[model samples]
Target: MKKQNSLFARKPAKSPKSKASMDYPETLEIIGLSHEARGIAKHNGKTIFVTGALTGETVRYEISKKHRRFDEAECVEVITPSPNRVEPFCQYYGQCGGCDLQHLEHSEQIKAKESLVLDQLQRLGKFNPESTTPPLSGSDQEYRRSCRIGINQLMRDGTPIIGFRRRGSSKLLQVDNCPILINPINKILGKLKAVLSEADSCKEITHAELSMGDQQGAMTLRIKKPLPESLSSSLQKLAEDNEFRLYFDNGQQINAFGDEADLSYQLEKSETQIGFKPGDFIQVNASVNTQMINRAMDWLDLKDNDRVLDLFSGVGNFSLPLATKAGSVIGVEGVEDMVQRAQNNAKQAGLNNCEFYRADLSKDLKALPWYKQGFSKILIDPPRTGALEVIKQLEQHQCDQILYVSCNPSALARDGAELIRQGYKASKFCVMDMFPHTSHVESLVLFEK
Candidate 1:
């Protein structure tokens, strides 16, 4: 048996003796990385989250609280630098907490994410995708427009705060301006915060989901509870006051339309026009999504007669595009609205061979009417959970080729194991830095039977 390394052994936490000790953090070297922002430094082999430390960074953190095995606090001083460190671009970068990795360079972020995929493929899946396909990639900034931001109704001191969660915590980060976001949505965020600060009916409010369409934005309000009719009037007034369309969702939805705007996207030197809603799950980095899709298509190596099945396909994102080249395409989605929107998008695109079906893809795929279609090509773009059931079904079906786009690698690895076990092989994959300055990594893998 391999001996446990002393670096991973937990160090005995010292008592909080002096107040000065709390303010002046003990400088420590960061060795290994914790799953999150916390890094690991060990006296023995026992592990703890080196508060305020990034992987390879050496820093000191004021230990606010300590236990037998771990210590926690905000990062205080940088004793030494990590090779991966970069100056943050956003002025309010660290304070905003919208992105955790603003301190790393773009290329480093991609490499880190790719490394994660390689780790998962080797360790969890017990296979390698070191050479299968070219990596998927996208832009780093302004890629996120659809997000559910939280708002603190009133601070303990009666002040108000609204925005994303704090770094390494569930507490909300208070800020009026978020520089990492797209300008238009950031404007809405500022205005909305200002408006909520004064609204009489809105004593406390949760965050809102803002999505950008090709030309307009779709906004949804996720209130804490059922609001009064007068409150609805207030929301409308707020919208008119700011010149932006806003929708309210008090456990239910009240849809509203915005003035039509045209949006154009580039794909393989071709610019495709799109009309979208602010609340729809448009890829955060639109330009990067185009590149990612292009790479996926290249990896697919499609044929004119190939029949493609797109799982977790949102609004014909991949399905419709495949239809442009393939014989027929089927898109499966859990949301009826998204499914219908995909159909509309296909019609608008003048693609007749694509079809969209509404089904709970997270559940069993066998229940879906289209499960047994036996498609020649398959693509999955699931949420953070990745595609477990869908992967299982694919293994059972044994499609000729599959392209899986994922945001979470752990889940991807879990499913990848099934694919390898069932005769499918992960040939190649790359991590795209869709989000920079944060821990999130987007991945793409091509598996073949």
Candidate 2:
């Protein structure tokens, strides 16, 4: 067994006499940002990481978590604020973990994200992209079309909190409205709180997912216990009054109501619309997502003879669009439901050239039928873990070009190194503001042999 190091052990709380010996409310000058977007500083020869601090700013912060070589602190006052600093519009900005960069100017946030991606690529992959494309951007506020709000214990005043988790904690922070959510979704939070807090099913619901399309909104409740019929009827009425769809999921079954309209969004470039269930994995920022797909098509420079493969394809977000130019497109997803949904979406879009398949992409796919097929272009949009196994076989499949839509820079870098080893050179790279005011960075890269 490995022994715990003493240097990193927690220090006991100080007694009255030794309270003066403690280091807190310490003044520090931030020099950089950590991967989590926290400000980095050095004080007393030991590194200190400060939350809510920006680069080149001096802040007064108190230690929140102690460590061996570094300590974590929360900014109490910004004695010297950066010129890029701006007032956060969200009332719960500091407490909510959903939006970390809300205090920074939106333009500055883009610059920081570009730097972060470049740093990760150089440090982890040891290579620079041939060229950097201008970032794809969109509205900074009220852009989130989908969000999952936590339902946890009520406050001392007996009001339940329905919002995001607090920073670095499991506690839920009650929010009346979120500035980042679309207006339609934000408008429903108050009524949702009122109905949910007073319902007998209040404690039974673990969380609620809110999603909105261009024309309609939907909410899904993940309930641990069966809701009373009366309460379910009330929720249905609430959905009808607000012109939204509602669904409830107990441990065993799901019930839905007021689903007159297909919860869907249109891809203007392809003239295709995609329908998704409440729990499907649709991109939260619709405006940026459309731009991203358009950018992906441009970067791929698709030819009519092209045969493309879309890996980790979710509900045909990219497949149907790629089919617009490619001769044939194959979309592979891990989840069976998503595979079915993708096929349905492609069929609805009148895209006969596209097909969907369910496969576990994390494992070897050398013998798979799709693996045997030759692809002129490939698009991968894996989760944070990335598509290492799939990239490892790209050379064997004789793929000519590869485009990656990355949500995690580190994972992209790791997989990029593998692609480089397979004789692929990154030709273009660009960042996307898919998630504004958050540390999350979305990037796109194009590679060719």
Candidate 3:
């Protein structure tokens, strides 16, 4: 047999199942942010990933590794805030790890975010005319109508765990009230913390999904240990105490959790009700979502008979609202649960004109059945990866108007280039500050085909 290569020998035959837990560098400074999710700090001309840090705040972190270009570090402290800092509302502000920009002024956060978006558009689209650029700023706080939290086991103790991932990895972060989540969810943080603190069997938790339903909020705990027989009682107490349903994961939990929990959201400027589940992906800032949808619709200039397509549609956020104006609105999503929720929400809102389909839009989207139709307006809301293939599909449909909502600038730029390749001009770009105190930016771009 041939000898194994040194590189192959050093590497595992198979990828490690578990992610590496890392400590941020013990010492670091708040340098800046690319958008908002990541923090930038350089040490001795090296870079570090400082988990749990804000710009201008001197902090301590543990170094994860050293690369030829930069080092990765996770946050451990928040020494000081920049002059533009503000107090955080959520009790779980730091520990929850859901909202990092809570410490900065929400308005200032928008200005910074707008700068980032404009910078990216110029860099990628290479546009400079003011006619194609519009000043974009809108609601900057209390925008999260939907959010997700990881549910996992506690440490050595039996503590039940629920909340966002740690600063840098899958490790669960201990959290209380989330600053950016709905008041209904944030209100239950303390009770949740206390409950999990008492669960001795909680040791190897993974993820928790928090969702806002049509009338209330729901919490799903993904625990590593077997749920106790008193799971209902514990959850009942928690719900009574916090006014939100408690859901347990594992093979036995499907009904017990769903039957007890229901989440809801009030549509902006309307009485439309949206129901969501723990696993459903909703916008973190409900308020901003409304503005975003409004802006996208405005940019698309939907006519009464226009057909609109919303890719990566979650909970019918844009699709539901857009349906109110357009002749027909179609939403495409990857998660079936979210698709169902969107459909249910449409039914509840009495919105028959809106439809949702579930399919993976990340890869080749040509196989999707609903994708056969051409659209007058296309709204793409993709994750950090942005909508590359989806953009291609839109090109295939010969869409004339495109509104792109992006959270990642680099990916947005890449996809923007693809749109340019397809003869779409970046007509207007603006930024929405969904996150404050952190270097994150939410951007909206309108392109003409």
Kindly list the per-residue Cα lDDT of model 2 for residues 1-449, writing each as its tens digit: 22112111223233233213665434779999987889999866888887888898887666666779887777766778888887788887777778889888999999999999999999999878999989989999989988988987565655677888876678888888999888888877777788776664377878888888878878788988777887777877777777688888775655685455368899875569898877789999888899999989988988989999999999999999899989999999998888998989888889999989999998888788877888899999999989898888787765789999999999999999999888899999999999989999999999888
Q: Measured by TM-score, how close is model 1 to the native structure?
A: 0.84
Give the range where candidate 2 is weakest over 10 consecutive residues by summed lDDT.
1-10
The sequence of per-residue lDDT tens digits that candidate 1 reaches over residues 270-306 is 5344445444566777767787878877888888899
Residue 271 of candidate 1: its Cα lDDT? 39
User: Candidate 1: what lDDT?
Assistant: 0.68
**Comparing 1 and 2 on lDDT, the stronger one:** 2
TM-score versus the correct structure, for each prediction: 0.84, 0.92, 0.75
Q: At residue 38, give the lDDT of candidate 1.
A: 56
lDDT of each: 0.68, 0.83, 0.67
| Global Cα lDDT for candidate 2 | 0.83
Error of 2 at 388 (Å): 0.9
Off by over 4 Å in 1: 1-27, 62-74, 132-139, 155-159, 224-243, 257-279, 362-369
